[model samples]
Target: MKIFGYQLGGEKRSGSIENPTVPVSAENFMQFFGVQSGNLPSVTIDSALRVPAIAAAVSFLSGSLANLPLHAFKPKGDGSERIKGGIQKLLNEAPNPEWTSFGWRKYFWQQVFTGGRGVSWIERNGATTAAIWPMDPSTTVVKRVNGRRIYVFDGKSEYPASDVIDVPFLLKKDQISVYSPIMLGSKAISLALAMGDYAGGFFAGGGVPPLALSGPLPAGADAIKRAQSDIRRSIDSAKSNDEAIFPIPPGYKLEAVGFDPQKGQMTEARRFQIEEAGRIYSLPPVFLQDYTHGVKANVEQQDLHLVKHVISQWAKALEEELNLKVFGPRSNGRYAEHNLDALMRGDFKTRMDALSRAVNSALRTPNEARNLENLPAMPNGDTLYIQGATVPLGSQPLLQAPPTGKENDKGNENGDGNDSEA
Candidate 1:
């Protein structure tokens, strides 16, 4: 978002964040997320994430999903209640001793977004889940063997599909490997990275383009070297003395060589790359902190856009995967769900207003609303309430006058409390 002060680092190291200068294969791209260099840099996940747009998109998505409140639920009567214990703790708290739920899930989704696949093993002690362990998508391979899927980790251990939780950004026809975002969006990402490389080197050289020395140049090779040496010495001397002006040889001049950033349309090109990266994840530009085309309505549409077209789809992908693997085929209607209230924690006033309306309309009990705000329940707050003045759709009006039929006066005279006075 803050483009002017982008903290682009030193030039990319060559022959190693470089590649060993070896050619990498398309098939092995997912295995190692390898990079191949050429006319355009081969986009590996590492290089792709270096682009600010890709980094922002990946971080936003994974971090948002990681913070969601995941809980296991079981059907109770007409609906389902969040069930607590090992499974819930495993999902919402600590998956393994080494990692918290948030940490694991963030890593999981990061892989899903970048490498195009996320995988974990659901460790079990007999029939009960013991702990969950994440696998590196770069090192783990999924393949179908004997008409069943298996996860092979580091080419050694193999896990049955029934015991693995897997989500792919997109599944290939073979269902063994996924189409990596970096590889699939290579053209755009490669351009973004190339721009970064050029920008880094350009700005590092004092934001000045290469200088071309001209005029009265000697034709002989030895003479040209002498002139170049003299020019270098003069420039170095001027710089050392902090002088603003340096003299050139008689009839010589210096001018910047090649196209400047503006001439290259760097700003527009960079902005377009951000939009391109957003498209890879189907994310709205607003979500990527791109406000060039943003307005009030466009910004507000993000919540719906994210939930409907982005977050919910990935969340459902994960939910289905986790459920299928963790609970087996006959899950008995017990499922793990993500509570999306975490996404609406944008600001205090909006959240409070929503909760207030929910409570006043009897959509949620006062205590339930309080629980969302981490507030203690008040006395009798668990009960649902509605406006007392409301009536059934076809019911008689309150405090209505009696009918004017002849029997009405006779009936009232016998039964009404004011009969004697009348």
Candidate 2:
């Protein structure tokens, strides 16, 4: 099968003398077996493949996935034949019976079925019932960068046992401005690029309308153009200073960012912004709105809230969810065994909870209950009474006596009481 001008079982364009130029355009590339280019061929392929790049991307991805020896090698296990048998079970059990891999029969069997989790099924009515093949672990690798473990081929063993981690997927200048600071490493160039692109995309996607530009931007063309310029600059900056950038893991953000060339410290700023009503704001220096707020896309409230919660949780403590079963518990060849150790020590929730507990404990005192009782009522809430030796409730001092006992003394002094002495 061919896709985007690339042939299946074909060699990738490795800048080898045989194929010096990779498919620069998606349209001109040959479509793979049953892999529809859907107007890809009609799109013009610029020198750098502007429009037809999608085809090239698809081709590249297909080529990469194809490189992994799938099904070509026979399993040596005594249960070797079980691989194919396992796949067949998954196909019969999948809810979408018609679902098929694009003309890649091996993919259907190897990548989808009998891949990672292998195959499991239920029997019903004396017949084999529903079954599914989890993704294969032999081809996947996930591990913690902090640890000396480098999990490869389903996390079987740590590579090198060294802490020097390799950042996946090298960065490109134009691609710099897409993700958040947390998504990018603390490299200034990457962060700037991300901010610029996010800002540009917001304007481009109609997130912020031109009419809403408070200043400088004349809306529409002008706003978009400015965003584009900003993103371009950010990308340029990122490429030059790769080391300074910090990569944000799934849910974390830079906090309390600052740079001291002497100390060799450039870290994420931990400061957060308080949104007052609808206005957008930020903590100075560390981060800011990527683009003009009015020009960006307005995110869905639910999604934004969820993302915010996740990011906040990550920023505060990465340990809690580190071991969460986002994938699963079993060793089916995915990430680490529950990172319970990480979560227990580094989870944002755990840290936040600990902090809260400490603060509450500090606020308590020996006479807190009595103090609260004597506290004055206010329009908003109760006020703490701290000054008096003892707290007393009600309108008057606790030491004061009723008028009945003091009437005799008062009458002699005033000469006007009902018990007055001449």
Model 2 residue 54 lDDT score: 23
Error of 2 at 53 (Å): 20
Show model 1 residue runs off by greater than 4 Å. 1-38, 238-244, 397-422
- Deviation in Å, model 2, residue 382 alpha carbon: 27
Best by lDDT: 1
lDDT of each: 0.84, 0.31
- Alpha carbon deviation, residue 12, candidate 2 (Å): 35
Cα-based lDDT at residue 310, candidate 2: 29
Worst lDDT window (10 residues) for model 1? 10-19
- Poorest 10 consecutive residues of model 2 by lDDT? 270-279
